[model samples]
Target: MTAPVSDHYSAPRRSALAATVVALVASVTGCAGTRAPGDEPAPTGQALVIGASLELTGQGSALGTQQEHALRILAAKLDVDGVPVGRTRRPVRLELRDNQSDPTLAARQAGELAGDEGIQALVGGTLPETALALEGVARKRKIPFLSLAPGAAVTGSPDDEGYVFKLTPDDADVARRLAEAVAAQKLRRVAVLAAQGSHGDAGAEALPTALKAAGVRLDRTGRLPATGSDFRAAVRRVATGRPDAVLVWATAPDSGAAAKELRRSGYRGAILFDSGAVAEQTLRGTEASAVEGAYAVHPMSLNGSTLTSIAGSALARRDFMYRYLQEYGEYHGFAPYAADALELVAAAARLADSLDRGRIRAFLETQVVEGMAGWYAFSPSRHGGMEADSLAVFVVSQGAWTRIS
Candidate 1:
């Protein structure tokens, strides 16, 4: 059921839905295409259905729940009238399932969703393992998968990953940004405390090269136990060298727990985090004081733009933030990745003029949009969409993430 990869890229023949912020930007000239008069009929009412398998009730619930909220809010907004499809404006619909942070469950749910003829595309996977599991199913079914997880290997090679797309910035990008930040502070030595999974595996592998490039030395590295497990011993091991800083490469609440353990071990050096640690859970209750001064490399969407800018993307982001805060009472900066994913899929549907999985896959490769989260430039040669320029540094200050870079 795999989709055939196109050798040549085609320009999008029409503008994407206005609500999705798909306006052509200056960087991508000649991307907008025109349709011949009377080539297509008038708008027909239908629905663009998307499927999701998230970690709603398990270890990754903190991030997964935020994504769920984002998806719901975006769906409601787009459905106000509908998103522009070929000759029709289609309402967006979601079929969401809880994977419980289990890779096996995620794969099964992906299979079921992909099997449904009504489900046009898939999005979810807040954890690296779950995202990888979903990748397997999406590849087998030849369905387009937009992964919200942080992992370099999630999309592997574009040739083999014709149907898979990563919404998060690459691990190497985050590592490089973090390394440069550490170097800016003149920190010579750093220790790493990574989580026990694929996400941590990526950080562990990328940090050494990035640190070396930034003239920083790697002191030591240790692995944190699974969620709910004690982190004192692991933290103590990495803190033995009295390194100038420690990088906590794991998602919350693990990110916060590791910080707590580091503080308990009497290590007062700087604590750096990858984007996965930007969740609200990292700064809640006991974890707040521990992570108060910690820094993280995340997307610029976290800081958000003021309405004064008046850019379409800025306006779209401001609207999304307003809706998210109004509905959920608070905003988790990381949640917009899901909204971006859904919008990417809708944009593809608009360009392809069809809901066929193969067409969606092809158009998805050609997308270059300013999403709610950040800028994504997908091409036939690149499936990991989030650009490195989209990343920025933020610090946990006053119990909130405040942009510092």
Candidate 2:
């Protein structure tokens, strides 16, 4: 299957990089500044740099591309002067490095960002493994790291996760929701197909726990390469099980392949996918009937509801979505999450009234803000920053994703 022409996210433009960096400084008013312990003072005459390591040209590019794009968009719409710290605005600069889908490189770049670039905060990591790699750097450097991926590995231990935070729903939470959804429909047997990685492993581990009380049994389990091109063999094996439903936990194009293959096998009672498959564009050219009744567990809804319950109000969400469409030609599943992560950081900086990393980290632990996705609040015990209500079920009806619950 060919990628849609409009799906390609262009590289960052050099000419506007400085201007965009300057725009990222959000304004803060009426805040007193006190330097918090373990906090580093802001650099003089230089922008407050924030570094990001994203998979720019590899298997995870589908998701990372959107993350990078979202950062660029948010940088433009934030503020012109920079974030207000100590009654003065500090110019914010974004320095992005392409990890090319390698976790090692992601970690290496993160160290460089912290040691050499002097970035106060960091964002990126669409893949769970990459996030795990990035997490180490955050802990070692004590820089606030906002991960865009969903996995317990990103925010596992409070001691290890002090500097780490994520905006997306944890895979454990998503797996539970999916299991409950299956159990509600009286489906006792399920075929689980997960990709081979941290995301897949987390889902594989969480599903059974959620289904144990419901008495849903896994009839068969299969694992495929996270970025594998062919899934016919896995689909055939799953179809042979004749389970009540098939749960595919994988990233976009792979999830798309699973749906197509299952339909071709002609044994679908119900086809369900994980959060990564929620992006509507993943199944763009497929026949409506191919996945007509398919379901997905998504972190947030992008449809009809006013979204007033989320941060920034419905108007802000509307404006951001509109701008996203205008800029990218279509909305990617993770774009809003990435944008919201940046917004949350900026909001934290405003609350702290300083560019001090420790201050911002402390502020985030108790700060409650409505973001593009939904309500977000963090605590010492929870670094994932999401709750059970963070996920909702959606179904494919009439060739579109419709929120059913």
Q: Point out the worst 10-residue segment of candidate 1 by lDDT.
A: 1-10
Clashing pairs in 2: 25-82, 25-83, 311-370, 311-371
Identify the candidate with maximal TM-score. Answer: 1
Each model's Cα RMSD: 7.5, 10.0
Judging by lDDT against the true structure, name the best candidate.
Answer: 1
The Cα error of candidate 1 at residue 97, in Å, is 0.3
All candidates' TM-scores? 0.89, 0.84
lDDT against the true structure, each candidate: 0.82, 0.71
Model 1 agreement with the true structure over 1-405: per-residue lDDT tens digits: 111111112234212322233343221111112234565534656678999999999899999999999999888876765666665777789999999999999999999999998888899999999998999999888899999999883443555558999999899988988998898888999999899999999999999999999899998989999899999999999999999999999999999999998999899999999999988789898888999989999887897942124265676788789989999999888989999888778777877878888898898888777787876777777888577767778888899888777
lDDT of 2 by residue, 244-359 (tens): 99998888767777888888888858888888876544657763466678888875545624323322255566767888889989876567777777776776777787677888
Off by over 4 Å in 2: 1-46, 153-161, 286-289, 304-311
lDDT of 2 at 268: 58
C-alpha RMSD (angstroms) for model 2: 10.0
Stretches > 4 Å off in candidate 1 = 1-43, 153-161, 306-310
